[model samples]
Target chain A: MLTFVVFSVRRAWQGFWRNSLMSLAATATMILMLLLLAGFWIIQTGLNAGLQFIEQKVEVVADLNDNAPADQLLQVETTLRGMPQVASVTFVSKDQALQDFRARLKARGQEDLTGYLDTNPLPNTLEIKLKNPQDYGNVVDYLDGQPTVVSQVTPIQNLVNQVVTVTNFLRTVGVVVLILVGLTVLFIIVNTIRLAVFARAEEIEIMRLVGASDAFIRWPFIFEGAMVGLFGALITLVVLAVVATPLQEFMYGFFRVLPLQFGTLVVRDLTLLVVGAGVGLGVLGSYVSVRSYLIR
Target chain B: MAPGSSTGLLRHPTLAGDRPPETTSERLVLALRDVAKTYPNGRAALRDVNLTVPEGDFVFLVGPSGAGKTTLIKLLIRDELATAGQVLLDGQDLGRLPRRQVPRVRRKVGIVFQDYKLLPRKSVWENVAFALEVTGTPGRRIGPAVDRVLRLVGLAAQARQLPTQLSGGEQQRTAIARALVHDPRLIIADEPTGNLDPLISWEIIQLLLRINEMGTTVLMATHNAEVVTALRKRVVGLEDGRVVRDEVGGAYHRED
Candidate 1:
């Protein structure tokens, strides 16, 4: 068994360099396909991050009555914070709301109509953030039940529903596109490796005639396929690194307002994804291609 | 030159003097009983073909092209299944051998092709050793086995040359060396001298005769009437997929 493995590895190394043209062609195709897959995967990751940011923006604002007691408001805020669906609940006093209104008016160059009023009629509120956007309705209903402390819950249910619908559609489309691209890469890579195997049909035939076990003939090609995959992945990573350096500023500028996660986390996932797919597909492709020759 | 004058051909270390090679006197090297083969396209390649080659016998298979010569060889190598009967190699039924056991059984029979199926990229030594290498023979064992066979076939000096660098006879000799590396009980030569000049063809025929004299059974399929007639060996003639004649000390054609 040890001899077999050593022989297979040595043969694989020789076979790869012996047919350098075909091997190089296979590696080039593998690199191109991996790059395309990695590009799509990075885009998909960014899409997910942006959608998560959008979902977190779905908050429930509950306005308290002007005459409500401070203790009742505090109790309501504590209860909202304790709910499993609520990520956090912050108390906003009437003074802060009025101040925010004045700031927005000043920024927009509108007249300070709010300051002209003799008394501040703005209501104090509790802004509730949910762990998941889909739990918006449950939190709104819970806040509405607190009629004594909560005067009226802002009916942003329609806005939340619209946002959820758009975000869900985009997420589904993103996943579907990723799957389609994955299948395309699989077919193209497998076929390209098949062509490489086909070029050596005579060698395989001679091996078979010489009473070579299927494993003896098969494992060498599998190792060769793996070599192609390894080389392709390394080349892809180098190209991605070179390109990422120049594209960093452009990507940061475009995603500044979107709050997408783009750092070491994304880079790590992309590396694993590209390398894993490159090697896995290479082995699978060779296995499938060489199967027909060995069956008889 | 007459094959008998080939002085050193049969005198090598791995040749005639080497313990009279392990042939079981009572056992048959190959046995076919009522074997019939019809391809998927409904062409009947062989019908009611029954042949038995006992230990240490040399047989000649002669026929026109498409007379089931190739199909017969294919069945012997287990490359194709007999659509009807059994092909027994060394008392084991080929039809019933498990898929994984096919290679083991193939190693018992060494085969040579007319085209000399040598890898162009590999040297003569590598080509011969390839048979043993792919069979998972130990590296230490492969080197001597290959060396012995190359010396037996008189190609040891050209062992480093590639197939393209050698003549047709030299390439065929390399192939025969590869076939012999496994020390197979049966050596099947399928028109092995088809591409050679008559003089070179005689050289290959003499080499096969020498191997046969050393206790290996040889089944040669050929269209060479002159060599076949001159040898007067056991002849099995196939016509329209049927064995029309089987005779010992027979000429290539009927005496009439």
Candidate 2:
């Protein structure tokens, strides 16, 4: 068995270099397909992360009456924090709200006219972050039920519903597009390897006539296909590595608000996807291509 | 049992008539009984053919073009199945052998084509070693076996040369060396001398005859009438998908 394996590997190596054009062509196709898959995969990852950042923005805000007592405010804060669905609760004072409004206006290049007001018109509010954005029902109702201390709670159910629907639809579409691209890559790579195998039909016929067992004839081609995959994957990783810094800079520039942590995750996922798909597809293409000639 | 063993030699002569009839399988190297082959398109390539070549026999298959010679070779190699009847090699039926066992059966019979089928990129040494290499022969055994066969075919000096560098006869000898490396019981030559001159053809025929003398059965399909008539060996003739004649010590054509 060891001898067989050694023979197969040696022959596979020889076959690869002897038919350099065909082997190179197969490797080229493999690299192209992997890049296409990785491209879509990167886009899908970005889309998902962007949608998550949007969903995280959903929260319920309860406006406190200006003259509400300190003890009542402490009780409300404690109650909101104790709730299972609420991730956190932040109290924004009237002064802080006014300050935030001015900062936004200045950031947008509009003049802050807040100095004309006799007093701060913004309300002190408790911002409630839910563990799940979809689970805002209980928290919103509880805040709305606090009539004495709370003037009004934002009715954000309609807004949350609309955002969720659109984001979910977009995610589904992105996944469908990725899957379609993946299938196209499979067909192209498999066909390319098939052409390589077809070019050596005479060699296979000679092997068969000489009483070479199926394993003997088959394993060498399989190993050669794997070599193509390995070479393609190595080259693709090199290219990806070279372009990575620039690509990251571009991503940050476009999606500037997205966290750097999400970018790292995308990089990790892309690496795995490219390597896995490249090697897996190469082996599969050769198996399918060589099978037609093996069947008696 | 060693290949080409004659079980007939063990028979007791005193009670031969009463010992019951001998079945054909025990003595035959290859047997085809009532065999017929028809393609999917309904073209009949062979019809009601019956042939038996016993152990250590040398037979020539002769006929004009499209006389089912190629199809018959295909059937023997299990490249095509006979639509009816059996093709038995060494007592095992070729058609009934499972797909996985086909290669094992093929190793028992060495085949040579008219074109030589040499890999242009491989050296003559590599060409002959390729057969053993692909068959998973052990590393230690391949070198000696290949060298031995190369010597037998008188191409040991040209072993490292590529096929393009060799003469037509030298290339054919390389193919024959490849065929013999397996030490097969039967050698099937499909017009092996079709591309050679008379002198070179005689050289190949002499090599085959030498191999046959060493107890390997030879079934040569050829169009060389002079060699066939001069040799006066077993000849089986086919015409229009049927066996027109079968005779031992026969000429290429029938005697008056």
Candidate 3:
């Protein structure tokens, strides 16, 4: 068993270098296809993250009557916190609301005309965040039911429905596009490796004639294919590493308002995907190509 | 049993009724009985072909192109199964052999092509060693086996040269050495001398005769009628996918 593996690996190494041009061509194709797959994967991940960020922004805010008792405000806060659908609830006093209004106006370069008012007209507000944007309907209904404590709840149900519809469509489209790209990468990489194997048909014929077993004839080519894949994957990872910082900067700049970050988990997953696909497709392609010669 | 053992001998006193019986030491290396091969495209490449070769015999397969010579060779190596009957190599029915057992059977029969298929990048020594290497011979055994075959084919001095550096005769000898490396019971040479000059052709024929004398059977497919007629050995002639003639001390053509 050890002899077989050593022989196969040695032959595979020799085969790769002996046909350097064909081997390099196969590796080049693998790199390009893997890069395409990784690009689509990154885009898909970013789209998902951006969509969740948008969904998290779907919160229901209710304006409280100035005459509502302090105890009633506390009760509303406790009730919102106890609800399973609500993620969190925060209470803003009228003074704090006025201060926020003034700060926004000043930051927008508009004059602080609120300072000229005789009294603070802003109302205390209860801000409620939901676990899911789709669950906003239940929270809005509950807030609207508090007639004595609440002056008015923001009419955001239509806006939330629209956002959900658009996000779902985009998510579906992103997934479909990623799948199509993944399949394309598979075929292109497999075909490239097939071409490399086809170039060595004479070697396979000689091996078969010399009474080499099916494993003997097959494993060398498989090892060669794997070498191509490993080389291609390593090169691709280097290219990714070189461009990673720039790529992340470009993504952040492009989607300035979207919360997109390439966390360590994403990096690890991407590395695994590239390496796994490269090696898997390489083995699969060689197996399929060599099969035609062996079966005869 | 050892490959050349007399225990494996198949007495054909009844099988070949007209022919006189040979010494009891001779064993059958190859046999075909009513073997017919029809390819997928409805081409009948061979039909009703019956031939038998005993151990250590040198036979010439002579025929015109497209006369089932190639198909006959293909059948011996189990490259294609006979459609109608059996092809037995060394008393083993090739058609009944399992897929995994095919390689084991092939090692018993060494094959040589007209083109001398040697890997261009490898040296002559590596070319001969390749046969044993791919067959999983032990590393230490490979060197001596390869050296012995190279010495047998008289190419031991040119062991380090590539195929391109060798002459046509040398390349053919290299192929023969590779075929001999396995110490096969039978060696099938398909037009091995087709590419060489007349003098070099005789040299190859002499080498084959020497190998046959050393207790290895040789079956050569050839178009060289001059050598075929002069050798006066057993000749099996094929015409339009059927064996037209099979005779001992036969010439290239029918004497009567």
Give a tens-digit lDDT track for model 2, residues A1-296.
Answer: 98889988887787788778867877787787677666656655665666667567647888999988989889989998999998989999999999988986787577889999999989998888888776888887887888889999874555556656766786677668656755655565566556656766888899899888889888877777778888888888888888877887787677665543336676777777777777787777678767875676
Query: Tens digits of per-residue lDDT for model 3 on B1-256?
Result: 2323434322222232233243346678987877899999999999877788899888989889999999999999998899988788999999999999999999998888889999998899999998998889989999999999999999989999999999999999999999999999999999999999999999999999999999999999999989988987778888889877776666787775
> Evaluated with DockQ, which candidate comes out highest?
2
Q: What is the DockQ of each candidate?
A: 0.62, 0.66, 0.64
For model 2, state the Cα shift of residue A104 in Å: 17
Give the 10-residue window scoring lowest on summed lDDT in candidate 3 chain A: A184-193
Those runs of model 1 whose alpha carbons end farther than 4 Å from true positions after fitting are A2-29, A43-58, A62-89, A92-125, A129-167, A243-268, A292-296, B1-25
Q: Indicate the residue-level lDDT of B203 in model 2.
A: 98
Ranking by TM-score: 2, 3, 1
TM-score of each: 0.77, 0.80, 0.79
Which 10 successive residues of model 3 chain B have the least lDDT summed?
B8-17
* Model 2 CA lDDT for position A214: 89
**Candidate 3 ranges beyond 4 A from true positions:** A1-29, A43-59, A63-133, A142-171, A179-187, A246-264, A292-294, B1-26
TM-scores of chain A across candidates: 0.63, 0.67, 0.67
User: Residue-wise lDDT of candidate 1 within A1-296, one digit each (tens)?
Assistant: 88899988887787778778877777887787788777666655665565556556536788899888779878888887888898888888889999988996686467888756889898888777778755677778887888888988864555656656765776677667656755555565456556656767787788788799989988987887787788889999999998885565565456553544448888898898888888887787677766755565
Fnat scores for every prediction = 0.71, 0.84, 0.65
lDDT at A50 for candidate 3? 66
Candidate 1 residue lDDT tens string, B54-169 = 88888999999999999999999999999998899988899999989999999999999999999998999999988888889998998988989999999989999999999999
